[model samples]
Target: MTTDDKLVYMANQIARNFEALGHDHAVAATEDHMLSFWDPRMKARILALAVERADALGPVAAAALERLRAGVVPRPQTGATRFAAVDESGASDAG
Candidate 1:
Protein backbone atom coordinates (compact mmCIF):
# COMPACT_ATOMS: atom_id res chain seq x y z
CA MET A 1 0.00 0.00 0.00
CA THR A 2 1.09 3.63 -0.47
CA THR A 3 2.49 5.51 2.50
CA ASP A 4 -0.58 7.69 2.69
CA ASP A 5 -2.80 4.63 2.68
CA LYS A 6 -0.70 3.04 5.39
CA LEU A 7 -0.93 6.18 7.48
CA VAL A 8 -4.71 6.20 7.09
CA TYR A 9 -4.96 2.56 8.13
CA MET A 10 -2.67 3.08 11.09
CA ALA A 11 -4.55 6.13 12.25
CA ASN A 12 -7.86 4.26 11.96
CA GLN A 13 -6.49 1.37 13.98
CA ILE A 14 -5.33 3.73 16.69
CA ALA A 15 -8.73 5.41 16.69
CA ARG A 16 -10.43 2.01 17.03
CA ASN A 17 -8.23 1.04 19.96
CA PHE A 18 -9.14 4.22 21.79
CA GLU A 19 -12.82 4.26 20.78
CA ALA A 20 -13.84 2.51 23.99
CA LEU A 21 -12.64 5.57 25.84
CA GLY A 22 -15.46 7.60 24.23
CA HIS A 23 -15.27 10.42 21.66
CA ASP A 24 -13.28 13.21 23.26
CA HIS A 25 -10.97 10.87 25.10
CA ALA A 26 -10.49 8.68 22.03
CA VAL A 27 -9.50 11.69 19.92
CA ALA A 28 -7.09 12.87 22.58
CA ALA A 29 -5.58 9.45 23.01
CA THR A 30 -5.17 8.99 19.27
CA GLU A 31 -3.56 12.41 18.97
CA ASP A 32 -1.24 11.71 21.86
CA HIS A 33 -0.29 8.31 20.46
CA MET A 34 0.57 9.77 17.09
CA LEU A 35 2.49 12.67 18.61
CA SER A 36 4.50 10.38 20.80
CA PHE A 37 5.13 7.60 18.30
CA TRP A 38 5.08 9.14 14.83
CA ASP A 39 8.05 11.03 13.47
CA PRO A 40 7.82 14.58 12.13
CA ARG A 41 7.73 13.40 8.52
CA MET A 42 4.94 10.97 9.27
CA LYS A 43 3.01 13.66 11.07
CA ALA A 44 3.43 16.12 8.20
CA ARG A 45 2.35 13.53 5.68
CA ILE A 46 -0.71 12.63 7.72
CA LEU A 47 -1.56 16.28 8.14
CA ALA A 48 -1.41 16.76 4.40
CA LEU A 49 -3.62 13.74 3.89
CA ALA A 50 -6.01 15.08 6.48
CA VAL A 51 -6.49 18.19 4.39
CA GLU A 52 -6.44 16.49 1.00
CA ARG A 53 -8.37 13.27 1.72
CA ALA A 54 -9.81 13.18 5.19
CA ASP A 55 -12.70 10.90 4.31
CA ALA A 56 -10.31 7.95 4.21
CA LEU A 57 -9.78 8.30 7.95
CA GLY A 58 -12.12 7.27 10.75
CA PRO A 59 -14.00 9.94 12.67
CA VAL A 60 -11.79 9.99 15.72
CA ALA A 61 -8.66 9.81 13.62
CA ALA A 62 -9.88 12.63 11.42
CA ALA A 63 -10.59 14.78 14.45
CA ALA A 64 -7.17 14.06 15.87
CA LEU A 65 -5.56 14.96 12.60
CA GLU A 66 -7.49 18.19 12.44
CA ARG A 67 -6.38 19.02 15.95
CA LEU A 68 -2.80 18.35 14.99
CA ARG A 69 -3.12 20.52 11.94
CA ALA A 70 -4.46 23.23 14.17
CA GLY A 71 -1.48 22.92 16.55
CA VAL A 72 -3.44 21.46 19.47
CA VAL A 73 -0.79 18.94 20.32
CA PRO A 74 -0.57 17.33 23.71
CA ARG A 75 2.86 17.14 25.30
CA PRO A 76 3.89 13.53 25.74
CA GLN A 77 5.77 12.69 28.90
CA THR A 78 9.06 10.93 28.42
CA GLY A 79 10.19 8.10 30.72
CA ALA A 80 12.18 10.46 32.92
CA THR A 81 9.31 12.87 33.19
CA ARG A 82 6.74 10.14 33.82
CA PHE A 83 8.80 8.59 36.65
CA ALA A 84 9.62 10.47 39.80
CA ALA A 85 12.84 10.04 41.71
CA VAL A 86 10.82 9.60 44.91
CA ASP A 87 8.46 6.68 45.38
CA GLU A 88 4.75 7.01 45.88
CA SER A 89 5.24 6.76 49.65
CA GLY A 90 7.39 9.91 49.51
CA ALA A 91 10.63 7.99 49.87
CA SER A 92 13.65 8.31 47.65
CA ASP A 93 15.43 5.16 46.45
CA ALA A 94 18.63 6.95 45.50
CA GLY A 95 21.68 6.62 47.67
Candidate 2:
Protein backbone atom coordinates (compact mmCIF):
# COMPACT_ATOMS: atom_id res chain seq x y z
CA MET A 1 0.00 0.00 0.00
CA THR A 2 1.07 3.55 -0.62
CA THR A 3 1.99 5.62 2.41
CA ASP A 4 -1.20 7.65 2.30
CA ASP A 5 -3.25 4.52 1.89
CA LYS A 6 -1.49 2.91 4.80
CA LEU A 7 -2.09 5.88 7.01
CA VAL A 8 -5.74 6.10 6.18
CA TYR A 9 -6.16 2.37 6.63
CA MET A 10 -4.57 2.45 10.04
CA ALA A 11 -6.54 5.46 11.12
CA ASN A 12 -9.76 3.78 10.13
CA GLN A 13 -8.82 0.58 11.88
CA ILE A 14 -8.07 2.51 15.04
CA ALA A 15 -11.34 4.38 14.67
CA ARG A 16 -13.27 1.13 14.37
CA ASN A 17 -11.71 -0.20 17.50
CA PHE A 18 -12.50 2.98 19.36
CA GLU A 19 -16.05 2.92 18.10
CA ALA A 20 -16.43 -0.63 19.32
CA LEU A 21 -15.24 0.56 22.71
CA GLY A 22 -17.91 3.25 22.75
CA HIS A 23 -15.45 5.96 21.89
CA ASP A 24 -16.82 7.25 18.64
CA HIS A 25 -16.48 10.83 19.77
CA ALA A 26 -13.02 10.12 20.95
CA VAL A 27 -12.17 8.66 17.59
CA ALA A 28 -13.46 11.73 15.80
CA ALA A 29 -11.73 13.97 18.28
CA THR A 30 -8.47 12.09 17.94
CA GLU A 31 -8.62 12.26 14.16
CA ASP A 32 -9.12 16.00 14.39
CA HIS A 33 -6.14 16.21 16.70
CA MET A 34 -4.00 14.24 14.28
CA LEU A 35 -5.05 16.28 11.31
CA SER A 36 -4.50 19.63 12.99
CA PHE A 37 -1.54 19.00 15.26
CA TRP A 38 0.35 16.04 13.79
CA ASP A 39 2.89 16.74 11.08
CA PRO A 40 2.83 14.50 8.07
CA ARG A 41 5.77 12.58 9.48
CA MET A 42 4.20 12.13 12.89
CA LYS A 43 0.96 11.12 11.29
CA ALA A 44 2.90 8.55 9.35
CA ARG A 45 4.49 7.20 12.50
CA ILE A 46 1.20 7.05 14.33
CA LEU A 47 -0.38 5.28 11.41
CA ALA A 48 2.45 2.87 10.99
CA LEU A 49 2.33 1.92 14.62
CA ALA A 50 -1.41 1.72 14.52
CA VAL A 51 -1.32 -0.65 11.61
CA GLU A 52 1.44 -2.77 13.04
CA ARG A 53 -0.23 -3.16 16.42
CA ALA A 54 -3.76 -2.04 16.02
CA ASP A 55 -5.12 -5.01 17.90
CA ALA A 56 -2.96 -4.34 20.91
CA LEU A 57 -2.41 -0.61 20.85
CA GLY A 58 -5.59 0.88 19.48
CA PRO A 59 -7.23 1.47 22.85
CA VAL A 60 -4.15 2.93 24.42
CA ALA A 61 -3.48 5.09 21.42
CA ALA A 62 -7.05 6.37 21.51
CA ALA A 63 -6.79 7.21 25.18
CA ALA A 64 -3.52 8.98 24.71
CA LEU A 65 -4.90 10.97 21.83
CA GLU A 66 -7.91 11.89 23.92
CA ARG A 67 -5.71 13.02 26.78
CA LEU A 68 -3.76 15.14 24.36
CA ARG A 69 -6.95 16.75 23.08
CA ALA A 70 -8.13 17.37 26.62
CA GLY A 71 -5.05 19.46 27.37
CA VAL A 72 -3.31 16.91 29.49
CA VAL A 73 0.36 17.28 28.90
CA PRO A 74 2.14 14.02 28.53
CA ARG A 75 5.16 13.54 30.72
CA PRO A 76 8.51 13.06 29.12
CA GLN A 77 9.45 9.43 28.91
CA THR A 78 13.11 8.53 29.24
CA GLY A 79 13.90 12.21 28.65
CA ALA A 80 11.90 12.25 25.45
CA THR A 81 8.60 13.99 25.07
CA ARG A 82 5.92 11.32 24.86
CA PHE A 83 4.14 13.29 22.26
CA ALA A 84 5.67 15.56 19.65
CA ALA A 85 4.21 17.79 17.04
CA VAL A 86 3.55 15.50 14.11
CA ASP A 87 4.25 18.33 11.75
CA GLU A 88 4.66 22.06 11.39
CA SER A 89 0.92 22.39 11.92
CA GLY A 90 1.63 22.03 15.65
CA ALA A 91 -0.76 21.40 18.53
CA SER A 92 -3.81 23.47 19.12
CA ASP A 93 -3.74 25.68 22.19
CA ALA A 94 -7.47 25.42 22.55
CA GLY A 95 -8.69 22.31 24.27
Candidate 3:
Protein backbone atom coordinates (compact mmCIF):
# COMPACT_ATOMS: atom_id res chain seq x y z
CA MET A 1 0.00 0.00 0.00
CA THR A 2 1.00 3.61 -0.51
CA THR A 3 2.17 5.78 2.38
CA ASP A 4 -1.10 7.59 2.71
CA ASP A 5 -2.92 4.30 2.56
CA LYS A 6 -0.75 2.97 5.33
CA LEU A 7 -1.40 6.02 7.43
CA VAL A 8 -5.11 5.67 6.88
CA TYR A 9 -4.97 2.03 7.85
CA MET A 10 -2.99 2.78 10.97
CA ALA A 11 -5.33 5.56 12.00
CA ASN A 12 -8.36 3.43 11.36
CA GLN A 13 -6.84 0.63 13.38
CA ILE A 14 -6.26 2.95 16.29
CA ALA A 15 -9.81 4.27 16.07
CA ARG A 16 -11.18 0.77 15.87
CA ASN A 17 -9.27 -0.21 18.98
CA PHE A 18 -11.03 2.53 20.87
CA GLU A 19 -14.42 2.02 19.23
CA ALA A 20 -15.73 0.09 22.18
CA LEU A 21 -15.39 3.20 24.34
CA GLY A 22 -18.30 5.05 22.66
CA HIS A 23 -18.16 7.92 20.18
CA ASP A 24 -16.83 10.88 22.13
CA HIS A 25 -14.46 8.75 24.12
CA ALA A 26 -13.22 6.94 21.04
CA VAL A 27 -12.50 10.23 19.32
CA ALA A 28 -10.63 11.55 22.33
CA ALA A 29 -8.62 8.37 22.75
CA THR A 30 -7.73 8.22 19.07
CA GLU A 31 -6.61 11.83 19.03
CA ASP A 32 -4.63 11.35 22.21
CA HIS A 33 -2.88 8.30 20.80
CA MET A 34 -1.95 10.09 17.60
CA LEU A 35 -0.73 13.19 19.41
CA SER A 36 1.28 11.07 21.79
CA PHE A 37 2.80 8.70 19.28
CA TRP A 38 2.70 10.20 15.79
CA ASP A 39 5.40 12.49 14.55
CA PRO A 40 4.53 16.07 13.59
CA ARG A 41 5.15 15.32 9.92
CA MET A 42 2.88 12.31 10.09
CA LYS A 43 0.15 14.40 11.65
CA ALA A 44 0.59 17.09 9.00
CA ARG A 45 0.24 14.53 6.24
CA ILE A 46 -2.78 12.98 7.88
CA LEU A 47 -4.34 16.38 8.33
CA ALA A 48 -3.86 17.10 4.65
CA LEU A 49 -5.30 13.75 3.67
CA ALA A 50 -8.15 14.40 6.04
CA VAL A 51 -9.03 17.48 4.05
CA GLU A 52 -8.48 16.04 0.60
CA ARG A 53 -9.67 12.48 1.15
CA ALA A 54 -11.68 12.50 4.29
CA ASP A 55 -13.98 9.75 3.11
CA ALA A 56 -11.21 7.21 3.58
CA LEU A 57 -11.00 7.69 7.31
CA GLY A 58 -13.33 5.91 9.68
CA PRO A 59 -15.83 8.03 11.62
CA VAL A 60 -13.83 8.14 14.83
CA ALA A 61 -10.57 8.66 12.98
CA ALA A 62 -12.11 11.50 11.01
CA ALA A 63 -13.37 13.18 14.15
CA ALA A 64 -10.00 12.78 15.82
CA LEU A 65 -8.18 14.21 12.82
CA GLU A 66 -10.60 17.10 12.77
CA ARG A 67 -9.88 17.85 16.39
CA LEU A 68 -6.14 17.81 15.62
CA ARG A 69 -6.48 20.05 12.59
CA ALA A 70 -8.67 22.47 14.50
CA GLY A 71 -6.16 22.76 17.36
CA VAL A 72 -9.01 22.57 19.84
CA VAL A 73 -7.13 20.23 22.13
CA PRO A 74 -3.88 20.46 24.05
CA ARG A 75 -0.76 18.89 22.52
CA PRO A 76 1.04 16.12 24.29
CA GLN A 77 4.08 17.32 26.21
CA THR A 78 7.41 15.86 25.20
CA GLY A 79 10.39 15.20 27.43
CA ALA A 80 11.97 18.49 26.43
CA THR A 81 9.03 20.49 27.75
CA ARG A 82 8.47 18.42 30.85
CA PHE A 83 11.36 19.73 32.91
CA ALA A 84 13.09 22.98 33.78
CA ALA A 85 16.50 23.69 32.29
CA VAL A 86 19.30 24.22 34.73
CA ASP A 87 21.90 26.85 33.97
CA GLU A 88 25.58 26.68 34.78
CA SER A 89 24.87 28.25 38.15
CA GLY A 90 22.24 25.62 38.84
CA ALA A 91 19.31 27.98 38.63
CA SER A 92 16.22 26.62 37.00
CA ASP A 93 15.19 28.41 33.83
CA ALA A 94 11.54 27.75 34.41
CA GLY A 95 9.62 30.83 35.42
Winning model by TM-score: 1
TM-scores for all candidates: the values are 0.77, 0.38, 0.76
- Best-matching candidate per lDDT: 3
How well is each residue in 31-95 modelled by candidate 2, as lDDT tens digits?
65466566878765765565565564566455655454465653332232334366645345432
lDDT of 1 at 49: 90
User: Residue 5 in candidate 1 has what lDDT?
Assistant: 92
| Residue 84 CA displacement from its true place in model 3, Å | 16
Can you write out model 1's per-residue Cα lDDT over 1-95, one digit (the tens) per residue? Answer: 99889988999999999899899888988999888889999999999998788778889999999888888976552223333454454343443
lDDT of each: 0.84, 0.54, 0.84
Residue-level lDDT of model 3, residues 10-54, one tens digit each, is: 999999998998998889888988988899999999999998888
Clashes of 1: 0
Candidate 3: minimum summed lDDT over ten consecutive residues — where? 74-83
Q: Flag clash pairs in model 1.
A: none
Between 2 and 3, whose lDDT is larger?
3
| Candidate 1 off by > 4 Å | 75-95
